[model samples]
Target: MKKLTTLRTKVFAAVMLTIATVAATAQTNGSGRLVKQDRDLPGFTEIEAGSAFSIKVSQGDDIKVTVETDDNYLDKIETVVKGDRLHIASMGMKNPSAMRVYIRMPELKTLDISGAARIETDGGITGTTLEIIASGASKVKLDLNVELLNSKVSGASKAEFNGNASVHRSEISGAANLNALNLKTLTTNARVSGAGKASIFARDEITADLSGAGALSYYDNGQLNKISKPGTLTFTPQNPGSGPSEEISASVEATDAGDSTIVKIGDIKVSVREGNPTKITIGGSELEVDDNGNVNFKRKKQTRFDGHWGGFELGVNGYVNKDRQFDMPEGYEFLDLRMEKSVNVKLNFYEQNFNLISNKFGLTTGLGFEWNNYRFDNNVVLLKDGNDLINDNFLYARNYNKSKLVVNYLNLPLLLEYQTNRFSKKNSFHIGAGLQTGLRIGSHTKLVYQDDGRKKKDKDPGDYHINPFKYDLMVRVGWGKLNLHANYSLNTLFKNNRGPELYPFTIGIALVSW
Candidate 1:
């Protein structure tokens, strides 16, 4: 019996020794390393990253991926390129010790993030749409230039946007927080049963629908547009000199009558009867009453522009001939070009300084850069001909597929603007007309074609007979950031008879106003 027990003990010691040796070898072979990958994926439209990892993204012409992780989990990190989208995800990591990924790609159309991850970026993100869904204890921080943003948080997650954005729409139901800075338009629908909060700073209008016990705070330069909440909602407008201001004041007085409470503030009144609900009325509109007995006060909508006179404006335009004139240089004719497809895109960075003559009248002047893209209808190439630019039809034998002209200018604009209700508490109406002069800084033409299933491009830079100086009549009319703009150039696109005798004009919607 003693010998058999000793034999079992020896067998157990051998098994344990083998296991320790294998584990040590595995650890040595699976140690972490720094990995870098780069990809040139043009025409990729979107980005989707998920899993338990920290990701940092930037903007570039191509996609660059860098990872630092243990070799044991190196095989678990995967990057998949499917169709027009690139996805990076981490798998097989139940509880990862350390992992970091950095991605750099071109401007995307959409960015989607999910899982228990920390995603961060300092600018360099420009898209039309952004979506984030966090189900774990995740966090996201970004400075984005997006027209629309949509986010949803279901766990103890947090999301923050610290740059200028046009619109933001969000929904939160967990112990999450969504904070935005320099946000223009915000619309939130939150049902927070936990300790959640949503806050926005330096915004224009906030439309919110709140329930549960969460809190929503909005700090705007203007008044709140609308609020429908069953809980607490607070809005504090910036002071006069800090931003756009509306003169608003209110005094509340409470009276007790027959076991009831009656409060009066300005022209608004509220009655809270015992064993009944609270009632409120402002002018002729009755405020919606909630079961929580919470009272909300909102000013009438005001006509104010957030970040006015000192921000950036990005927009695209449709360039078309105002009057049909089929006159071109001899031996050159316009090709089959779709009028709707001929597009011009512009980006302006300016600072507006205002000189107020009265409450309703003002003069505004600003300096900015105007980057213009004049895409041709078809593959028409431009050639220099003695201080003139004319279409070269002989270059079509190479079967050029795409061609466009790009121009950049330093511009200065002066305008006289009129605003109704500028001193009133109600919304304002605005109209501005001005003259703008531009100095040509750069001009070029590009042609693109396909060669052996691969795309090739050529750029030609010159005066191209383009005018060295240009001026235009510009007008803007709208209430807020959303305004209609028109600019008619008084000069032709090229020198006199240097090219087609076509006057250039642009009609488009301005996302920001002066």
Candidate 2:
């Protein structure tokens, strides 16, 4: 048994290592100058700027950016710190994103930047190297491209490419959403995330290789040519609906375009790339994937079956750190202080594979019913004293509670999952992630307080139902079937509510696994 566990660990490690190697080889870095990075987070790292926007590279360096209050600016760096080996992540969460650093990077070898970086490379793609390394947090975005050197991305990496991308060979995390049209080379790796499509082209000498977990999808609309490397390809095709077609457009390739890339697909996979596809015309609706799109397995509504013995879960989790700059509402003549609260939760069908996704880390995906939500409420004291109560927003405004923030949703989500020790019995673990299309199941508010606080009338915040589709991240750590867990709602707490963006997170013990 111990040997089996060790083997599982080894296999899992090997899989992740392969992915990292693939992403790393596909990234880009140039010149040998260290430009400052502008961290967009309120508590993230900053970037340095350059005068002429020259290219600079660095190997092995670490930087930390703390985005604090009252200060958000950008600057450029002219030099790269020599001999630094760690990467300080640049979070891209704010607007007017800019930061300047004082550093130098001359004759550097490699450059690495991770975390949420709103990166804009002014210089052209030259002798630059790019890669995704080990990370604990999950990231997801669209419309950015990292030069692929070797990629071992475990978090969500997404972007759209209008230009051609050049890559050697790299692995992609199931969370990576890449859509590029101009054909080029994509050396094989593991899973590709999302429902987005791109025109894939490999040099005739290059082959489309795939390994590791998740479903495989290969489809196109051209001369479905013969695969050169037949032995390297694998597949077992099964289409539930009118999803996967029989052919893909052939790209003009060199003689060694290897064999027809084989596709080894699991359940829940679809592939459609570029141009209106030829298909049977039925019911006046063209039965084909076009700019209108097809090869998509989108259920108008996918709910649970009765007697499935599955219900849903509700959660509330979030943090209320002390607001350094407390901006009271307009014309508030009185105010008070108290600890804040953040509420977040994931209520999914209990007895279903969806429950198998315990968002304890990174991202995850599944199909089931869910009513997940989160929010934040200030720990408010109506006034520091009765003297300040007259002008306070909490005290004077009769419609203040009406401004209370609430965000709830009913949704169908596409998720990506990254686990740490999923294959081990002694220390196996899983994290749940995925998007949710929460149809407003129900919403209610409570006025919670301890007797140590002052007395007030028992007023319910009333009920509200808003349509919100949300993405969630949850991390759980445990052995076997039981784990300690917390879920954080990644969406704003209120869409139409009249308050600040409130995020809710919930924590609880769960019996979950991959």
Candidate 3:
């Protein structure tokens, strides 16, 4: 009996020895000295593109993608196609530069995935909708239709979802350029670096609960629904006045960023949700008439816009948020392309510095002609305007300036419009800051002076003598039909101190042909 017990002990010792040997061999890396795949586990046994181990999954079955490529280089991956109900993303990787995937479920409606993996797709689930959720600091390209999509990141993450995007607890570093977006959902705790540019191609909604810092410039695609008040549902960038005594839980740390918020909708609704502390960022319009669908973006931010001097069509136009706003930022005036409500038009916010050096319309000098009809129907200048002089002068009739002239001019402008199409659908933007060249064919000017401070004079200053050969500077924006343009002639129109400068900036409609 002692001998049999001794035999069993030897057998157990032998098995233990074999297991230890196997463990040592498995920990070894790839190619020792040469570059090869990291063969860590059975599932990670092979690391070659096009070589996949897939399990046939039905509606109820779980669909998972597990990758373990530690420290090894994964270059130029084609794609991983997952046709299952549930998708899992578990990857042990370092620098995954370029990797794409196309996923779809033949049975399920929505796919719920968890884990860390960087994937770039056309922005679709089943290659049709843009309902793809990304975890970790992953990059994704979405151009398809997505009903409801959101990406959450726990740590530092960077992902680019070009189409409509909704993020939760993620750090979208740089390289997240949303070209023509319907809406951008920046709730939760997220940080954006630079002033991102978003051209709302349609009437969409923007919910910004920002607590960090970044710049955001929005180009409303359609008729713009401007908001008069600040958002209540959305949080401004957080202010960590002083260091917290204890580590307080926050979705985002404002210390790591510069913040901004931009919301584009038809009018606005700034109301507190019932029985909820969170303020809801909702558009004035409904997403659907029958049922609640995904957020919808209609084109209504811009409308019947034509260059007053150039007669160019109005489209999506604004600064990249990189320039300085001496007077005002770009997109100050919302063009109601939707043309739904009573529209109000004005000059767009512009940085004239760039236009000064540009040869397209800035700096350049040329000659042109235009016929303008200044209609003072909608009191846009009186509606909360930042320019104090503009509000007072718009109300002051040029004929009241005690001059022999009235407010009227046939702008024969010959100004070189040096502009550029930096990045967008339009070719180039006409620099509205160029020194203009023009010949004034019509008449009318109001001359006001402090000499008559005691008694204000109201008389036609120049009804007969028109400002001829009115050559100065001119700058215009927009293309085709909609435009917000202005021109300031370098040479003064009046010969004496009685008349004002050729600074007649008319915010009206000018339809440009070609």
Candidate 4:
């Protein structure tokens, strides 16, 4: 019996020892020999590269990294994390195998890429700023959601951005190309000693200073503010709607008649003496060109159609339910809606028009956000049961003076507009009739009153039986910047039979028209 007990104890000990050894192996070599090291770095803010290697970065909570390389080149890469910045570089240029580095971190404040390196992102990176300095035939590609970006390229390097950005500023020298897409604004100062090019697409505005034989191309809706010496600048306007087809081209040529230069663009021609570069004569108008190569057209009224406009509008809104179709629950009634206190606000991002014939009649469509508020005349409360909105009187409450229902929506408006003079700055009679569709974002009721001599407020957030989708018929008529607007909802305010069948209408004045 004693020998059998001793044998059992020995077997149990051996099993536990084997289990521990397997666990330790998994902790060290689970990802295989491709990953040399995996580590965590807290409070990392930026990344800087020193040499030509591939990198993939992604957004995460705490900074984490995995160094991936071939077995033969595992000892040829190094990663260092310092205060707010992480540095990745090659130990030496002797290794022929390329290294792949993967990084995960929180949103960074800056990303600096320099030297001969290839840096990419696993997904779109959001940050405040981005900087890239490439040399020695290196390449950098980024999918970014950044607010500010600055890039500088020298030697034979190239950089491209595939995501949206708010503002981008860049400088290029040597032979390279910088391509960016969906940029809101772009500013570039380029000097091409050899052969270089910069192309930007879907931009709102472009400001460039070009020198040497380099070229720049842009497709945008906004104006081009340029200072060019001897390079090519091609601009394609972003026209969404059908309009009069027009092509504009300009070129400068040296004339044999003295040291003057002749600038010919379509039917307009200007002659500039070399000694008097600022003075040019176009048609019968004498224009002054600024030192930055900006020509002002204020000397004559230049009438051109601007295809798109964006701005905001604020107005007061009031609803009318004359048919009294709104049905309340057994113990509740809707107080009179206050027309003076109700408000409507819209933020128009883009309004594009296509000319049907000339520019007098057009079709317009755009994207915007609409916020509507309807203030009730009495102190009332709202409750929601499932998808139904139920109204309850202030039975347990007292001294509430104001109660309002607010609804927010994302709206798309399609209209047919007509104007007497399409390209006039003066008063022009304009009228538009349209249909708008809205997707509900949120709905809430706000109540304000005095309780025991202290001001108090209550807010309730829910669907409130408001329709998830709404469509309305709208019309606008006015002169120039001022217009009277009206909207009538075709659908009931609530879901079928869930609440009142109120058809809402708004009459207000829009401050601006596009």
Candidate 5:
């Protein structure tokens, strides 16, 4: 009996040891392992996400919420269902990158995000009416097969949509970007304000209200009713024969042009040529007063259309190597630029236009001066020599606060321009494409650095292997007073075999124009 009790005690000790080891192993593994838990939540018709949590939603017969995250974070995340809305959020978690919530519901009528959370639908959202609201830097991409879609996006958020909807109503403000170009809609009512940008695909009808520096581009032929305030706005249609076919009535604003008084209403204009016997011109028809003061109606003669030039432009300059890539090739890293800081400014001070094809088309010649600043990403200075490679000619020293090369050019451009509505300056759509030739007026290198706790600036004038004369292919397109321009250099930036074969280009917006 003594041996039996001793053996039983030994067996109990071994079992207890094994159990403790297993418990410790599990605790160690659970600390770093991810845990997935499913919460049996009630059915919800709407969903809201906040606090930077990623959410994936799908449609199913029953509602289910499955959360996957670090084992310790499983309890910190919140999934609360109140009435018909399911709210998914994190309480105090600093890093929620690993947290993912998968939601399944029978129907989803609304999806709202009030934080920087990323929400995407696994499949198409099918319903009669669907509303999506996004704010606070959130990103939402959804596929919809709904009858009606109402979306309001603000802040720096972006919303992208695809699929088919009968009607889509969108209001976008701030710096938001709305890309619904693939979401085919029969009718769309859009309001874009601030610096927002929207690309939409509407088939039949579209009503657009625009303000601020916003731009709207639409695909497909849609009859438009547009209202625009006094601001820089761009309306571009992607498809041929798209945009407004009929003009809507608007308040009139009058401006004087020489001896003529031009009254503008929306995109339409009427000109009254004032003199002893006043004459009025409307749409190609003219009402004239003779010397005897007798009223007569006649067909109006073709008039001259003023070209759009003489504007102040601000843009960013970039370089593309011989491989047509923005990245510099090997041994050419010193030529890499701080592209965002490489500013390009232009002042077009003079313009001359010659009419062609009854004032609808013209040839425009303009004189402008361009100031191009190429800020180097590396701390290197350009040397003044036309005989050596850039790598062999530059000096690299201490880290400077600013290192840049400046080039000033006197530009002469010859453009063939066309206008859609020649009668109204505020309503016409104009596009110009032409060649620009430039002569280098000045070139210099500037460096700003600190020396012994004191800021010092140095400027050195140099040829720096830069091309004395350069040519570029330039294109300009705009609606009303808002215009955008791009230029691509045809020749290399530097003399052949002297520096890296870089092609310079610029893209920018016209700030002020006449």
Candidate 6:
């Protein structure tokens, strides 16, 4: 019986030894040098990182992770998935500058970060709810489009936010700071303590509680209720203080000066001179009332213009054939696009306007970047055969989950713009039409699929016979803050006779403007 027990013990020890050998071989090659590695992990909705590493998260259909680091430290990083949470940390190393981790999942519900780790999202995160918790002097930045956002910052951590949200609730303590003035929310509730500072934007209602030496700044004209104790509160230009905190004396006076009757009310002064004009001066600004009882704000005599070219735009991309039809005319069905998936993005970074007639009409010019994606509807890929693009379906063993072609251009536009109001941006109607020219900067094709239960992405960048230069007629129309833009190509998508004779166009609304 003793011999039998001893035999079982030896077998158990051998199994443990074999498992350790396999794990060590997987982390390094025969040379004992560590290398870059990818970990196949189960689905997780929560992430917890406790190290000083650069982490980027994005939305995807499946969970994927790629860890890039120096060969010496590859074996020291640890990624463990337990339950519905993924914990990332380093065993003993501290602040490895060569480490970068890219993580993607279908959705994310919660993120917890400690230490000095820096985390960011690749694009806007849209979901029902998102919760962010940061401590230990960490940093987090996200572009959010969510229904509800809950953020907590402590221990000198900092968080930056942009995009839009329906409601936001945040708590800051210690010396932490929350900078969310660019995140437009419908309603907000915030609490600050210790020496933390918070800046937020709200549209409808805001309720805040402040204590200690913390400060709060908000961009909203909505209803506000605050409980302030030693902390300072500030208002941004989107909404200003309605009245003075303390009551002050007021007076009115009238006088006559050289055939002009002058009336003074508070800081406003009105001057009415016969056979001239009725002018009102408030501080340094001047307003003139014409014969028709129209009050117009006098502007500088220099060339005045209202430009509508600088903004961020999003739209769908499409191409029409030679006959101006979307339907492919036989032998060209491969170029067909999935309209909903083909996207166009424009970032108008700079703009200038020169007035031609008052502020109503002006010549506008701007610099922008145009990113166009053509997602294919069929299960095929475009291959460059000489100078022409041909369709092929034999490159992959499995069907791709997503396939798309991307083109980027540096764009310059010259437009004639008109505005209905000079300075009343809230009530103005604007229209701009112009010619836009673009220089193609880059092009690529991307494919995503599953290989043996693992998600994989393949990117191939090449010219693909795309036109080097493009010209388009552009139009922009908007009322108040809502703007819509459209573009129609004046030339074929590809060089003459190189590919299908298709003209690309886009129509979308401006998501943001200045």
The candidate scoring highest on TM-score is 6
- Expressed as tens digits, the lDDT of each residue in 1-514 for candidate 4 is 3463355345434433433343354433222345457755556778887576788888887778888776656666777788878888776444444477888888766666765677787888887787666664568787887777777765456788776566677776555667663443434333443335576543334555576545565544433322335553434346332211233667988867768778787557776666564665555566777667887653443244333223345555544333533333343355345545777877554455677866777787766668889887566677776755645664666556888999998877888887887656345787889898989999999988887788888998878878999899988776666666677888877778676557776555543333
CA RMSD per model (angstroms): 24.4, 21.9, 32.5, 24.9, 24.3, 23.1
TM-score of 4: 0.45
Which candidate would rank higher by TM-score, 1 or 2?
1
Tens-digit lDDT string for candidate 5 (238-352): 3443223332455544445566565656545565555655556666777777577799887654477788876667777777777766656666777777766888998775567
Mind giving the per-residue lDDT tens digits that candidate 2 earns over 1-514?
Answer: 3463355346434543443354355533322332344343222122322122222222123333322211332221222222344233223323222333322222222333343333333222232444433221222121223345443443333332322235634344433433333323334332332211112333322333433222233323322233322124533322222212322333332224453222223222223333435343222232345565554322222132111111123233332212312233333312211112232333332222332333223333333343333222233323222222222344533332211233445444444434454333334444444444455555544333434354443333333322245555544443444545545656644443333344444455432222
lDDT of each: 0.61, 0.33, 0.31, 0.64, 0.77, 0.77
Instruction: Note the residue pairs that clash in candidate 5.
Output: none
Please report, as a residue range, the 10-residue window in candidate 2 with the lowest summed lDDT: 302-311
Q: Write the per-residue lDDT of candidate 1 for residues 235-317, one digit (tens) a residue.
A: 43452333222334466544455576667765678877766667787875566455785655544443442222322343333
lDDT of 4: 0.64
Q: How many angstroms is residue 284 displaced in model 5 relative to the true structure, after the best TM-score fit?
A: 13
Q: Model 5: how large is the Cα RMSD against the reference?
A: 24.3
Q: lDDT tens string, model 6, 1-514?
A: 3463355346434543443343354442223333568889889999999777889999888899888776667778888898989999887654344567889988888999988789999976778999999996689999888899999998657899888888899999766889887787877888887657788777667767788656687643442333446644433334442322122334544444567677876567788877767988876578999777888886433336767876667777778778776766456677767766888998765566788887788899867778999988777677888767777866654588888999999898999988998766557899889999999999999988888899999899989889999999998888876777788999998887678889998877765565
Residue pairs with clashing backbones, model 6 = none
Output the better candidate (5/6) by TM-score.
6
Error of model 6, residue 353, in angstroms:
0.5
Better of 1 and 4 by lDDT: 4
Between candidates 3 and 5, the one scoring higher on TM-score is 5
On a 0 to 1 TM-score scale, where does candidate 1 land against the true structure? 0.43
Clashing pairs in 1: 32-70, 303-427
Model 6, residue 333: distance off in Å is 1.6
Model 5 clash count equals 0
